[model samples]
Target: MEFGEKIKELRTTNQMTQEKFALRLNVTRQAVSNWENNRNLPDLEMLILISTIFHISLDELILGGSTVNNMTEKLIKDGSETRRAKFNMITTLIGALFLFLGAAFFFIKAHSVEYIDSSGILHENFYLLPTGFFFIFIGIIIFLTTGITFVNSYIKSRR
Candidate 1:
């Protein structure tokens, strides 16, 4: 069942009016109405609060239905484009994070020389190595390549 359905079910089971629930949540009665009708979703904090007030775990409240499982199965079976879009988005985010971390490491190494010997002459800093820059470059390349792949896949799947 969708979250709204669960909310309505729980509310009815407890015999609580929308007005009462709304008051408890510090929201308007219309907001409760909206939630029950699936017109909108509650924010994470409110969702947690609702689960707590109803004495149910978030997992139980959100995912305790065979209907939801069947829906997921159907979506997976269908291989819908929407799923591809979601995958592309996830891959893009992962690639971006890797690239950012790699770039950061590269910057840290490139700037390490600033903290070198007071002699202001040629010296070696064991902490800073040429390999660091190489890794950073590799990271940026991976990020760009992955980003391109994600965009391409997203576009192709849309078609």
Candidate 2:
């Protein structure tokens, strides 16, 4: 039987409704329905969870009644890698946004002008300058760390 069929059989044999199964998996009922209909395949984590909940081996859950091969491991690895790549991309983008905001603040601070008041007293708005520098420093650190992490992950994935 197919993976979806297997899942349906297991759910029915356990006397659980699709909604109940979805609740146990922390997913929506539609997601469970999709899985059962073979509209989509679950990620490695979800597959592992299903195996654990059903007391079945990953091999059986994934390969059904077929013999084990490198393809099964490859599928799991590819799914995991895709998830990691997406996470790294999001983190890098957030870090870049922080860096840009920090730079903009620093630029604004640099252009601030001092003025002489009616009493001939010089007034300079320097309070925000420190804040600007702090932001710039933090942004640089975050950008660097995130960039490094992305690069490292990329390199590891290539190998």
lDDT against the true structure, per candidate, is: 0.71, 0.80
Residue-wise lDDT of candidate 1 within 1-159, one digit each (tens)? 766778888998999999999989999999989877877767668868998999998667756575563324333545666675677677667656665665666677666654446776656454444555555566577667767877787688589
Reference-based lDDT, residue 3, model 1: 66
TM-score of each: 0.49, 0.48
TM-score of 2: 0.48
- The regions of model 2 sitting more than 4 angstroms off are 1-62, 66-69, 119-123
Backbone Cα, N, C clashes tallied per candidate: 0, 0
- What global local distance difference test value does model 1 have? 0.71
